[model samples]
Target chain A: MSATQSRPEPKQDEVYSALASARRPKPPGRLSMCLTFGWRGMLKIKHVPEQLIDVTLTPVLFLLMFTYLFGGALAGSTSEYLQYLLPGMLVQSVLFTSVYSGVALNADSTKGVIDRFRSMPVWRPAPLAGAVLGDSVRYLVAAVVVVVLGLIMGFDPGSVTGVVAAIALIVVFSFALSWIFTTVGLLLRAPQAVMNAGFMGLFPLIFLSNIFVDPATLPGWLEAFVHVNPVSHLTTATRGLMGDGASAWEIGRVLLEAAALAAIFAPLTVRLYRKAS
Target chain B: MSAQLAIEAVGLVKTFGATRAVDGVDLAVPRGAVYGVLGPNGAGKTTTIRMLATLLRPDAGSAKVLGRDVVAQADEVRSLVSLTGQLASVDEDLTGRENLVLLARLLGFTRADAKARADELLEAFGLADAAGRQVKNFSGGMRRRLDIAASIVVTPELMFLDEPTTGLDPRSRNQVWDIVRALVAQGTTVLLCTQYLDEADQLAERIAVIDRGRVIAEGTPAQLKASVGQGALHVRLLDADRRDEAEQLLARALDAQVHLEPDPARLTVPVTDAGRATGAIAELSAAGIELADFALGQPSLDEVFLALTGHPAEETVDEEEAA
Candidate 1:
């Protein structure tokens, strides 16, 4: 220990000077702080590229397996089913990816990183908003994966503008949907628990919707739920946008639902975030 | 006038469900010095620091950091103080440089400035070589250094270090102590929370001993030691069997109670007069109690805690079960 201690230590003085010379810069604007946190989220993904597996692989696998397994049984033909299933698959893929936002938030909370953020002078919601914003990239990636695989599998959308519009609508809905999971993330004690609850809630919503089959084929009681399900509305709106121009009413209704989810859950999430220990 | 104090709190309280984590705690920490809140695990040290740092709202009472109310002017307090939490608050998934850069950007530095500041901090903290590696791969000491570096990105007027050296090696702990000293030399007041008595004795100008959600004792290290006694004589017997006889003889010679240590072969006697310790040792030797070792030194904070609270300082308490 004495031998090591005898070595010249220049960094100690440098540390002192560094501390003495520090000048407080004007705090960044709320948007900049959010962007900085968003950058941090992206950096996490970059460092651990395996995080992209769920967003990329899950969508592609669902697209491949669902189109092949259910095409003849449900839609009467593979190519025909491809056109119908592609947009809905996009919706499922993006919505499934949204659960990760809450999971990541819960993980951050447990790890004490959120305490660091809370102690900072930055805008209170910047971390949550920034996480949702970062998850938007994952939503986009999942949307593209499903759509590009659909094009490869002989599904024809007929117009580039329609596909773009469909992808945009699903991403918007996913963004709004992320707030619900963020709320769950703050409420739950563990990331795994948040993930389990998110998937448990989403499974029924996605499976009962018109994503996989025609609602007309379902029993009356089940079909009633399929008709009113928000995910069903989102899938229908996405399918209409990709296949033909959607009605203003249909698009407007989906947008309204997204707005409503955001309005209700975003505030709730912020409140939970503020109170989270 | 209150501005001269780094922190002032009155009856600050925080409860989690049924547990009163911090109940009616008060603190007055003067500026530009390290003030230690010493306690074992789950002693409300973290909870109290959390409230002062504006991370947790006090259920009752009020705190002013740098003369700004923690609850009402929390943003101002946050801008003025930084908390390096008990947990390594830096993101483990990011590189050391990235963590510093992220904080610097959030603190309002431009792209170039953030990078420059991050690199400077990395270099100064001896993390320059590990800057590009993810923090999850860093050693415990490296991670702690980075956490402290993250706190001082903007040189907060007051910094809350909750158990800064809790699980660190002795060398790393000394490094952290040096950093704390350097920060104070640069005029940044530090609120250091630690379970290690020596850490508080080495760095803090004043110490507050907290237990069971309250401050049990507060003073300078010397004052706390003096309160326990002037000094103590610690003797280890070569044979554990003869310890009882030695304890009786030592108590008779020193005119003080002999404390049987858990070691079975060792006994501790608090002595106000150094002259009496020498006489007690002679009496022990005269009784044919073979001595393995003996030392006379000022009362350690452990003895101080024992004398003050009737329990050792390191006894683990489950006060933070709810937390």
Candidate 2:
């Protein structure tokens, strides 16, 4: 619009092209712009597996290393530690993996790929949407792979419905979270900045909660914050279903918290998403 | 499809802080003509195109494209035009066919329509055999052809090509020339921005030569050449400094109104007569002046550019973009 003419005399399309005028595409007929973008992501993944490696290996290693060394000090036994650590690892893996959305997006924007897309008549949200969907697969895959490996390593799953339901919730949260990080990526040009900011956030959130330790061990105020913490809800629900002696109300509470966060985070993230591009 | 005004840019000024990139240039490009904007780097050719492409904001200006106000009617303007930039802007990961089809689908074509259009473009651009090859591996020419092909899939009546053949080989450049000719044959209007004078000569119907952010000279290619000087001449100097001295002697020895480019190593003069160059060489040598290389031909856009801009097109767009 900086150059779209504002003259009183209206010009038709052909006249505009001759004059070397620039016009954007509107409601173009292609239904697969998002898929095309997704395909591009898949193509990029072929050239580099490092992106998925962090998602794939980071959670498994974090759980194994944290549980083996600190399990005694935190939970008094390795087995009890495994039960507590696995569920929170699920949420953490998804949240952490989503930060790549910001990194990859920033790289693409700086390279002028975003500018190229903006000039096209493709769907406005296709690039962001496709990338989110494509990358969410890694989060889902990582969570599942880590859990299956954890089970083989002697972590127990008590109820089939509970395990599947827990996994499904984490997937949705990760996708929602991707919307958030992607917005940040669009706003920032540097990927390293996004990674550092995401990591600095991750350390405290994981450290302050009952991800490994019993919540009863925390001080009163800190414990109160943990009681309502989103990670706590998911951990309690997963622990309860794993036969750690939680009540049905614990399951209800987790579902309610997850629903509330989804409701709160989704719309805010979407408005940010629109503005980022 | 026949709009009264194809483009209207009034008081279009785009500045970046202390630098006024496009310092209030006005332009009107009507339907079905190739309007070429020629300039050296930092002269705001690309910046002006960016404003027209709606990729940047104007500090103070208003434009309308195909009857839509740039800011107020951006989406409407977006619906009708296409731009092919200096570098090939196609996705490198996709195959030529996939790139075209994906763009077609995004542009609202049905699956069948998209495939059909993609196939047509592939054949048209001589990429049918390479349609399945990933674009990242493509030659410069192939990628440029694909870029233009992807943009024109919708048969946009308005196209903005900013230095479309900047780094292409001669064969690839000619391929684009054919494509531009084909588009014009179909009544599509093109606004071409290029540093290549010969390209403007071959493709543009009217030329707008910009220098230091203003239209210093404009007209048909022939008219611009006439504005600077008429025919061409060569000066032979035996030594380098004498080359400089010979330039001064020739400026006065032939036509008194002639202007000599500062560097006589590659000098151009207006007078066409062959004997005047020979006579000047004899007089300069007798007067103890020496020379190196000299030749005579028709007046070139290079001379016209130097004469009008007071500087050679020393600034390349690529180096400016790096900044």
Listed models, DockQ each: 0.57, 0.20
Off by over 4 Å in 2: A1-50, A218-277, B211-213, B230-236, B240-249, B256-291, B296-306, B309-323
Clashes (candidate 1): 0
In the predicted model 1, the residue pairs found to clash are none
Question: What lDDT tens digits, residue by residue, belong to model 1 across residues A10-61?
Answer: 2888898788778989888999888888898899889988989978999888
Worst 10 residues of 1 chain B by lDDT: B314-323
* Candidate that scores best on TM-score: 1
What is the alpha-carbon lDDT of model 2 when measured against the actual structure? Answer: 0.71
TM-score, chain A, per candidate?
0.95, 0.78
Relative to the unseen true structure, what is the C-alpha lDDT of residue A271 in candidate 1, on a scale of 0 to 100?
Answer: 93
Candidate 1 residue-wise lDDT, B1-323, digit = tens: 68789999999998889998887899999999999998878679999999999888999999999999999999999999999998899899999999999999999999999999999888898888788988888877788889999999999899999988776777887888888899999899999998777788899999998887888899998788778888789999999999888988988888888889999999988898888888888877887888999999876656766888998765453333223
Q: What is the C-alpha RMSD of each candidate to the true structure, in Å?
A: 3.0, 7.5
